[model samples]
Target chain A: MKFSILVSEGPYTHQASDSAYQFAKAVLAKGHEIFRIFFYHDGVNNATRLTTPPQDDRNIVSRWSKLAEEHKLDMVVCVAAAQRRGIVDEGEAKRNGKDATNLAPGFRISGLGQLVEAGIQSDRLVTFGD
Target chain B: MTIKKFMFVNRKAPYGTVYALESLEVVLIAAAFEQDVSLAFLDDGVYQLKKGHSTKGIEMKAFEKTYGALEDYDVTKLYVDEESLAARGLTADDLCIPVETMSRAALGKMIEEQDVVLSF
Candidate 1:
């Protein structure tokens, strides 16, 4: 079965993103395909490379980026949400006249259409939110 | 393209948080795909459709009117939970738009039949 995941909360502050990452790992280990992983609302914070945590704590953003690299996952952060939260890519940074792009590796900024497309394409759509 | 049954489950208040508004944004975009879309309002989400919202004091956009425009996008399947409405001291007459009020069990059944369920 193919499943798509929606993470709607930021890391550390909420467990939604962590739970979503674990679920994604479980799905892949069970030999199921992950159609996409969409980050929306505060969940877009997971795509920022600027996230810093205690040395002993789990680095949430890196975990997602690493997983996406290993699985070639289509990790998408909603552009509107990302813009509102200041998670910018190079193009967005240039277009918006920002100084830097903090979009983490393996995640791309996109429109809500990608999320709707995930719902349409995947056999199941699971949302992890507040 | 194959059409799928997409349901957006709204369970939050409109003003206190941004979930209700963002969820509606997705519904509007999904409408363009020509999919079978339905919206479920339960819990505090029922407040999203309440008539006569004044957000000027909160300085937030009064998006309550957007619900009426949803019909123009061919996305009019709005379901409000009867128990939730009653619990909140509200009724169908208090809402800004026309919706089918049903029991939670009935709404759950409808949700079970959907290909995708996106909760907000």
Candidate 2:
């Protein structure tokens, strides 16, 4: 079965992101296809390439990026949500005369329409929120 | 014409934050577009579905009552997660508006059936 997961919480402050990540991995391990992972609200922070935790600490953004890259998964962070939370990418930052957007590669900045499209296409839609 | 069904997922608490009310407004506004809209209250969102919520203390109108008026807007689909209601010790009878209750698995399947799903 193909499933779309919606992560609507940030990593450090909320369990929603971690739990969703774990669940997504488990879903893949179970041999199911992941239609997509749609990040919105605070979950947009997961796409920040600038996010750095202690070297020993778990870097969830990197974890998500690696997972997407390794599995060739489609991970999308909501563009409006990302911008609202000060997470513009290189083009956006350049256009706005800021430093850079710096969102990770495997994770693209899109919009809620992607979520809607995922909803329409996927066999299942799961959400994790805090 | 495909009356694209939309499930309005409300996941925030009702007090102080704009998400709860803003989510409601979104559902109402979408109903104007004649979309098939449903509401699902999960997590702290179940608080928004409780009965006798008078926003008068905050000098805001009691939009809680407006849940019933969803039928007026052709947004009759209403659902609440049973685990959320159970965690809060609430039953469907305790709410002012009528709603179909389901398990998380069922909710997952239902959300996939919609043409659109918006969360706030």
Candidate 3:
């Protein structure tokens, strides 16, 4: 089955992002195709490269990037939500006249249309949030 | 692929968090896909449909009016849990839009029938 995952919370602040990450990994491990992982609300925060964790702790942002790299996952952060939370990509930063961009590797910023497309194209659409 | 039934289960109130508003945004966008879509309001989520909501003092955009746009989007399956409304001293009359009220059992059955369930 093709699965699309939506994450709506930030890393560390809640268990939502971790649960979503685990669910995505489990789905892929089962040989299911991941249509996309659409991040919204505080979930967009998960795509920021600025996140820094303790040396012993797991780096959630890098973990997602690595997973996307290995599987070629289409990880999208909602542009509207990302802008509101300051998770800007290079293009968005240039367009908005910002000095910096923090979008992590392997994740692209897009509109909510991608989320709707994920739901329409995938067999299952699962959301993890508060 | 066949058309799948999608249910968006909203169990939270508005303004207090970003979930309610963001959920609505997804719903609006999903409408364009022409799927079998429904909105279920239970727990404090029932408050999202309450009429006369004013964001004047709160300094937030009053999105209560946006619910009215659901009709224009061709997404009209709005289900309000009767128990949730009664618990909050509200009725279908208190809401801005016309909605179908269902018992908890009926709501549960409806949820089970859906191909996909999203909660926010």
Best by lDDT: 1
Tell me the tens digit of each residue's lDDT in model 2 across B40-92. Answer: 88888888889988777798666777787888887877888999999989998
Q: Is 2 or 3 the stronger prediction by TM-score?
A: 3
Model 3, A1-130: lDDT tens digits are 9999999999998999999999999999999999999999999999989899999988999999999999999999999899889999889999999999999999999999898788878888888987
What is the interface RMSD, in angstroms, for predicted model 2? 4.3
lDDT of 2 at B113: 85
What's the distance in Å from true for residue B32, model 2? 10
Model 2, first chain, TM-score of 0.94
The regions of model 3 sitting more than 4 angstroms off are none
Rank by DockQ, highest first: 1, 3, 2
Candidate 1 scores an iRMS of 0.7
Error of 2 at A40 (Å): 1.0
Spell out the clash pairs found in candidate 2: A88-A101, A89-A101, A90-A101
lDDT of 2 by residue, A1-130 (tens): 9899998788889999999999999999999999999887778888888888998889999999899988999998877677778878776787678875678879888756677667667777788885
Better of 2 and 3 by lDDT: 3
Give one clash count per candidate, in the order shown: 0, 3, 0
TM-score of each: 0.98, 0.67, 0.96
Residue A10, model 2: Cα distance from true site in angstroms: 0.4
Better of 2 and 3 by DockQ: 3
**lDDT (0-100) at residue A25 of candidate 1?**
97
Q: Which 10-residue window in model 2 chain A sums to the lowest lDDT?
A: A111-120
